[model samples]
Target: MTTATPQTATIGHLLRDTDLSRPAYEQLLADATLLKHQRASGTIVPRLLGLNIAVIFEKPSTRTRSAFEVALHDEGAGCTYMDSASSHLGSSESFEDTAKVLSRFYDGIAYRGFGQNSVNELANHASIPVWNALTNEWHPTQALADMLTMMETTTKPLQDVIVCFLGDGHDNVANSLMTSAAILGMDVRIAAPAPLQPDPAVVAAAQDIAAQSGARVTVTTDVDEAIARADFLYTDVWVSMGESEESWDHRVPLLTPYRVDAAMMSRTGNPKTQFLHCLPSIHDSTTALGKKIFNRYGLNGAEVSNEVFHSTASRVYDQAENRMHTIKAVMLSSLASMTQGDR
Candidate 1:
């Protein structure tokens, strides 16, 4: 068996999936797995001792913020949380200024916000390593966690696995998934409406990665064809952050056809097909948004059904938990690279 051995020395900033090579990506997963085991066995060695990290967010978060804080803490690094109201990044002060200021106090900076250019600007201006938590273009951390979850669950090698994503393929989650899957040599397919298809540049980039890795990257309008033999069915909210509430009238109708219900799961033709979602999911008419969606569309769910979301095959929470482990791995590897004069 070929084990992962990432060239940590070469990795500088993790702004996107293209930042690391195939070996590095696999090695990161291997690192995350080892860290997870160490954590479970209560033998986790903190490599980042005495280091301070900043978690800056222009948007609200439940998993990313918690995961970063807990993961950094577990690794013996101090964490500082800066929410939208507290951190005047690009509002009262420029993002470049904030980046320079934060770089002074924090050894590393994690940013989750609206624009890709914003994060890019901070990375360009800051001397320290900058991690892209999320932007309209990509959610690299979530993709890492999702890959970890799939790595743990899949019976075969990573290259043999197939993951099909349904819903608005234009979103960050789908874009990240495509790039990561391509890098890891997993067969990935995205099914969505023509207008909601992934960015052409992202697709082209993933295609380039796929060529070397032997990963098949497919984007299509045919939902059945996309999930035909998929080992995992993945999706995210039809409407995402930075999108207007009024977009529901347009997106809901366009995307409802791609909803992952029991019929859709059955169509995969893989009985063991696992369900994956980057929550908070609209599986039932419980939450206010769920209730509103139900009232407006008369649908129980938007992207995924309650039956699949609550079923034994649902690995969404597992995906959620892996965020901390993989995130810790990212911080450790990035910081280690910096300390060893690799960057």
Candidate 2:
């Protein structure tokens, strides 16, 4: 049997088919946009007051860590950052015990663990909101940031857009995209080879939701047809974190045809076609890993060419910054309701 909290959980779980209505999701985007504007204009920010949150990161991250920590801090909430290396929860004790203890200490918990099952196990035991900072199966927070970025750039409802996701199209990011595409009414296309396509179950679920939203979902190896109607081009790293360097030899050849360079953009045929990524992109050698790969594997760019990733069309930075705003919405809304119920 699948582990789950009681029916009346605090925040709706962000799993593939969890019941987060589009109106609710859009409201979060709107709230985040407004908060961003307010913060930009120099105003006193909203505070979470009594809420306490904890972040447990198994994989090190620069953007995700900074965005979440700063988001809670800016909202006047107490945040305790945890280390997987030294933490008692998993390192010393069991996951179930750690989750139960954390549920009592914090209003919300965000964790990035080795496997998807670990995060799900925590949610099953913890009564409070459990956010997936990242997982092997999904990165829901990044999905929120992506949709928000698309809205910020296009000024169009997600339902009206054709968002094309190309390149290594079946990783954690791709899964999150498919999940959110179901939640919203966006036309979704994932172009990847047979071995790299999205999970069949996710595709079936998205097809079901698309039928309801009047959205179209298509999976194909034919890059030409996939990008024909595209407004936004999205991609992620060819190899995800925690993956060994040896995997590059296997991934590069499999993913090279899917790279987003000027030619692929040209194939889109949409002059206004925007680009989005979840950052830490291997489009350049800015990072040590990228440089090391360049030196050892003779690869300057992996899944996306630096020319496109750094071009005027790349919306990655905007996408990166939106993580803070959207995450705040998820935290505040859930915490507010908890406070009301307590009173």
Candidate 3:
């Protein structure tokens, strides 16, 4: 929470939990807009020019990987993709050693992994820029994508928007969303069961930010109140990808009341109020996993009711595609700042 001025804006620690700052955040939005239009027109320019990046991920990803790969290539940056099957930290060498080595080889490093501490370990030792694709405590990059999509679709400055996230609110995405909303000055709300709401410390931090900005931060169990005036309604998978079946049963019941279905959308009162999900959404049984779960659990229709999710008011895919643009922005701005730092 140092104010992002000309001086403090130069660093890249976003929410402390996530690794991003206002400079990187703003740059990400700009980069996303440029890439979105260019990709729409079937054009690609490598603004990264000759830069090379090493993508180190422990967790498997669909959109996150595709976005980073596409954005880096589009920016004209070389990317070395590494999975756990390949070179891994603490296996072949120390995380410190890998960080030091990759720093000399690549201009920057992107990691999707277990703990915030794990990422901090890399960033602490690495001289080059360290990007957090996802961490146990925060997903800063995804927040950027979410914000960019909201901006593009709503055509409103982030400062004036009202976004409400439902279901399990203590997850990494929720934490990142709260931090980003606080930093950007947007109304942020979380509606979930008491045990499932966001961390008290995180909410307190966001409240301090809301005190400064005009953001109306709310945390409650009342679903109707949360979505009543929301311009955008957002949610992620009820369970994290690798979570166990026990966790699913435990969480599903707790979050049942907070699901975003037709009734939930109606609470917004504005038919144009958009709905967004981070993808791999259980909105339908379109995918193999979704089908199996739908049959096994006798889910009847969908977690979200396909009618609502597939409706014209749903902007889920728009949010999905902006993942690339916002990430591109983070890379370009962070690297460019580093380059400018040399002068």
Give the CA lDDT, 0 to 100, for residue 92 in model 3. Answer: 73
Q: What are the TM-scores, per candidate, against the unseen true structure?
A: 0.96, 0.92, 0.90
Q: Write the per-residue lDDT of candidate 1 for residues 108-196, one digit (tens) a residue.
A: 99999998898899899898888999998989999999999999998889899999999999999999999999998999999999999
Stretches > 4 Å off in candidate 3: 1-24, 41-45, 286-288, 300-303, 337-343
- Model 2 — TM-score against the truth? 0.92
What C-alpha lDDT do the candidate models reach, one value each?
0.88, 0.79, 0.78
Model 2 is weakest, by summed lDDT over 10 consecutive residues, at 1-10
Q: Write the per-residue lDDT of candidate 3 for residues 65-85, one digit (tens) a residue.
A: 999999888777899999889
Off by over 4 Å in 2: 1-10, 13-19, 339-343
Clashes in each model (backbone N, CA, C under 3 Å)? 0, 0, 4
State in Å the error of residue 267, model 2.
1.1
The superposed Cα distance between candidate 2 and the true structure at residue 235, in angstroms, equals 0.9
RMSD in angstroms, candidate 2? 4.9
Highest TM-score among the candidates is held by which one? 1
Q: Indicate whether candidate 1 or candidate 3 has the larger TM-score.
A: 1
Ranking by TM-score: 1, 2, 3
lDDT tens readout by residue for model 2, 165-260: 888777888888876876788888998888889989878877887778777888999898899958898888888888887878888788778888
> Largest lDDT belongs to which candidate?
1
Query: Which residue pairs in candidate 3 have backbone atoms (N, alpha carbon, C) closer than 3 angstroms, thus clashing?
Result: 14-20, 32-325, 46-75, 46-76
